[model samples]
Target: MERPSSNGDCYLSLHNFKQGGLVYRDYLFTKDSLMVFNSFGDGPISQSTGAREYYFFPRKNVIPQFSWNSSDRRLEVTATDGNVVFFDYETTAMTAASNLLAK
Candidate 1:
């Protein structure tokens, strides 16, 4: 959907699907292009990308480094200011236990 900004500028509104509730990602239109927060990340990661080393760490480790190893075919991830993590391209863990399963 489209909406007008309070400053008289126009912006494009976006919606995101989340587990508990919906998320919104609004895009501001500029003269050249539309600018939006990269909530997801800079871009997609792969063996050639995430699987490799990254020198550009976030200011406060808020943005962790992720990579894929073509040799091992595994994904390597680093937590914010913590130990490194790896996944064998298997199922992802749930954020929290479902209420239906809880007392």
Candidate 2:
């Protein structure tokens, strides 16, 4: 939550909070995957399958939450019953990918 960089840009960091917990995140730019670990011990992490198309897919107990595209900052995911959801970092939020998918 705190931006340690003086440039004031959107960046990521892992630091310890006063409450005695670790917040960590790994941005795998190569795989276009992200692993976020919060204090609650439940993580929505990204795992690499090394597939050329989707590259990687996130799964928790056989449910894929998100997919990654390294070429473009896009995340192709599926919701309940294979409902497709996409997220593009080029803009912001899921709406960005929705726009691209809509087009």
Candidate with best TM-score: 1
Residue-wise lDDT of candidate 1 within 1-103, one digit each (tens)?
Answer: 3455687654333333331322223323222232333233344433112211222222234434456667865555443433344445333211221111111
Worst ten in a row by lDDT for model 1: 94-103
Cα displacement (Å) at residue 86, model 1: 0.7
* Candidate 2 stretches greater than 4 Å from native: 1-62, 90-92, 96-103
Q: Which residue runs of candidate 1 sit more than 4 Å off their true CA positions?
A: 1-60, 90-103
lDDT, candidate 1, equals 0.36
TM-score of each: 0.29, 0.28
**Deviation (Å) of 25 in candidate 2:** 19
The digit string of per-residue lDDT tens for model 2 on 5-24 reads 46533332222233333333
